[model samples]
Target: MPLNSYQHPCPGGYQIQAADMLIGGTLGARVNWGDPARDVVITAGHLVNNLNAAVFQPGAGVPGENQRIGHVAGRSPLRTYPSSREFLGTRAETPGQRITCRYDFAYIEVAGDSAATSYRIPGINDTDEPLAVRDPIEGEPVHWLGNTTGIVLGGHVRDLSYWMTMELDPTNAANRQYLSVQPLTLIEVQGTMPTRGGDSGAAVVAVNDRHIVGVHCLGGTTRKGRPFTMASRVPASPQALAEGSSSAGFDEVLTWIARTKAWVNS
Candidate 1:
C-alpha cells in the first residue's frame, strides 16, 4: 500500500503474490517466444496465480530491487466459453450466453537484463510505437495505466461483446474459489477513473492508440453490493464496469508461448 512515481505510471506497474495477498497489475508488451532477442512480461492470470510469488516493480513499499519481475512463464487455463453458438466461426456477435471465458493471462520469463524494463506502456509514451492488437468497440475510447488507477484518462468502451466474469481463485476454499459468472471476451471500460483492488494487470489502451484493446481485469458494483458510479453510469449501465481480457485473449497466450518454446528452452 505504498505508491509513488505518480502512482506507478511506468515500468509496467507491478506487485505480486496472491497467496498472501498483494496484487496489482500491468506490465505488458515485450514478447518474443523463442529468442528473437528474448523478452517476456505480460500479466493477469489473476495476477500471477502463485508461481511461487515475487513480482514487484515500484511495488512493495516503493523502492528498487523489490523489482524481481519474472518467473511464471505461462498461465491461462480454466476454460468455459459459450456465448451461444460460434466458438467456430470465431465469433461474430454471438452473445447467446453461456459464460466462463477465463483466459485470464500471464507470461513472465525475463531472466537477464530484466527484459530491458521499458516498452512504453507507462502512461503511454516512450516511442517505439509497435505494440499492436485490436478488437474492442461498442463505444471505444479507452486508456489505462494503473497500480490503482493512475492514468485512466477517458475510458469508454461499453462492451465489445460478451462478458460474465467473477474470478478470485486463491486455490479454492474461500467458498470454492469463485470464477462464477464466467464468460468474458471483455473490453468493458467506463470512466471517471478510480479502479481498485490493485488494478489487476492494466493495459487497456486505444484512446490515442497503441492498439492494445484489453488487459486490465475486473472492477465491480453492478448491483452486488451497490457502489459503482462511473460519473452517471451508462456505458451500458448494468451499474459499473472495468474489465479486460481481449487482445483476443492474447492470441491464446501467444499460441501457448509458441508451442512451449521447446519445453521452455529445455
Candidate 2:
C-alpha cells in the first residue's frame, strides 16, 4: 500500500550486510511474537548465519545515511528435525518424508533507539492484529517491497510443496542442504518485477488484502529452470547456488516462533 503517491516509505525492506559483502536480503518484519516487550526483526536465516553481519536501514550499498540498526539475535537451525529415524533414506517413500525440514529465517533484536515495538505494511496485517496465516493460492497475485527491487507487483503464486535447496561447489558437489519450513510447505512466486539478491527477506503479501503469505528467501530462476534475466544481480549468499526462487510460508514461521519461544532473549 503506497501512501500519497505510488511511492511511499515502507520500513521493512532494510539492508542486511556482512563485513565487506555487497548486501543480503531485506528485513522482513519487526515483531513481538506473543510478548510485547521483546522486539525482534525478521529476515532470511542465511543472511544472519554469520552472526556478525550488521543490518542497515536503506541497505549498505544504497545511497543514504544507511543507519546501522541491530545485530542477529538467533536463527532457526537449517534442519529442525532428524530426516530419518532408523536408517537413512528409509522414510523416502513415507507420505510426509520432508517432516524434518526447516530453513531460512533469522530474528534480530533491535539495539538502542532503533527498536520498533510494532510494525505493519499497508497490504499486510497490522502488527497489533492476531496472526492469520494462510496457504498461498496458486495463480493469485502477490506483492512485496525490497530494498534493492523496491515495489514488485503482479507476482503470481507458483508452488506450495516440499522444497529442498542445495548449495554446491563449482564442481557441482553438494556443500550445503536447506530444508523447507515443514513437510511440503514452501511458497514459490513468479513476479513480474524481478527480485534481486538483496530482496531475500522481503514480505510476500497478498495483492488483494493484508495476508503475509510468505517471506522471500531465494531468487534465481523459475520453476522450469529458466534464468531470471530481470534481476539486477544475485546476492553473494552462500546459499545462492544458481537455483530457483522460493520462500517459507507463514505457517512454518509462526510455528517455529512458538516452538522456539524459550530462546528469545527478551
Candidate 3:
C-alpha cells in the first residue's frame, strides 16, 4: 500500500500523532499488542500523560485526513518530584507502575474498524514470538517503515545496543528517562527517505520476513553529530499483557467505531 512518498512495506500501520490535532509532528511510537480484545499501541508515557485526546490513524500522511479509526487515553499519571541536586532542583518521573521510563511504554486500545486497516507484519500470526529480545545479527540489513522524511522507506539497520539515550523532554533533565535496557536497534539511510515531523510512532520491521522487531520511539543526532534512528522492542512476555486492562479505553474506541460503521451502512 505505497502512496505518495510513503514507501514503507507496512504502509497501513498506525502512526502516533503527538499533541498536534493534525498529523505532522514527532510523536510516540505505536508498539505492543495487549491482546485480541484490545490492540495496544505503545508509546512514551509522557506523550499521552497530559494529552486531551489520542486517536489512531490506519494510514499515513495526516492524522485526521484518513479514516478516524481508534481512540487512546493515558493509562497512568505523571510523577513529579524534587531533585536533591541544586542544578536540578525539581525532578518529574513517571512511575513504573503507571508506565514509567523503566519501560518507557504506554498501551492504547485500537478501535475495531481501525484494527482491520492497521499494518501487521506477515509472520505475526500470534504474540507467541519473543519480540522483546530479538537476536538480529550485526550487518544484517534492516529497514524502518514509518512516516520518515514525509512517509517513504529504504533505510538500513545501522547498529544494535542493549541501551541508548534520546532527547525526550529537553527542558527538564528529570523528564529524561533511561530507555529500557532492551535489544534496541537503529536504522540509517543516505539522503533521507521521507521521515518528517509526524511519523514518531511508526513501526520498524524486518524487510524480508516482515516480522515486527521494534517500534520507532525516537530520532535525533548522535554525540559525534551523525544522524540516527531509534526504536523500542515489544515485550513478548505474558506479564506485559497481564498488567493493563483492555476493556475500558481500547474497547470503547472500537465500540464507537463499530457503531459509526453500522450507522453509515444503514
Best by lDDT: 2
Residue pairs with colliding backbones in model 1 are 25-201, 26-201, 26-202, 80-100, 99-183, 100-182, 100-183
lDDT scores in order: 0.46, 0.48, 0.41
> Compared with the true structure, what per-residue lDDT tens digits does model 1 show for residues 107-212?
6666753644555665564564446555556576766665655554445664343333344643444343433222333333454334666666665666765666
Per-residue lDDT of 10-85 in model 2, one digit per residue for the tens?
3565555534344456767665532233556666665665565666554456445455667676554554222222
Of the two candidates 1 and 2, the one with more favorable lDDT, higher being better, is 2
Q: Rank the candidates by TM-score, best first.
A: 2, 3, 1
* Model 3: lDDT of residue 130: 24
lDDT of 3 by residue, 124-226 (tens): 3223332222435544555554434443354567556433333444455645433222235655644534344344555555666655555566665332343
Model 2 per-residue lDDT at 33: 37
RMSD to the native, candidate 1? 17.8
lDDT computed for candidate 3: 0.41
Q: List the residue pairs that clash in candidate 2.
A: 45-105, 162-184
- Residue 190 lDDT, candidate 2, scale 0-100: 53
Evaluate model 2: give its TM-score.
0.55
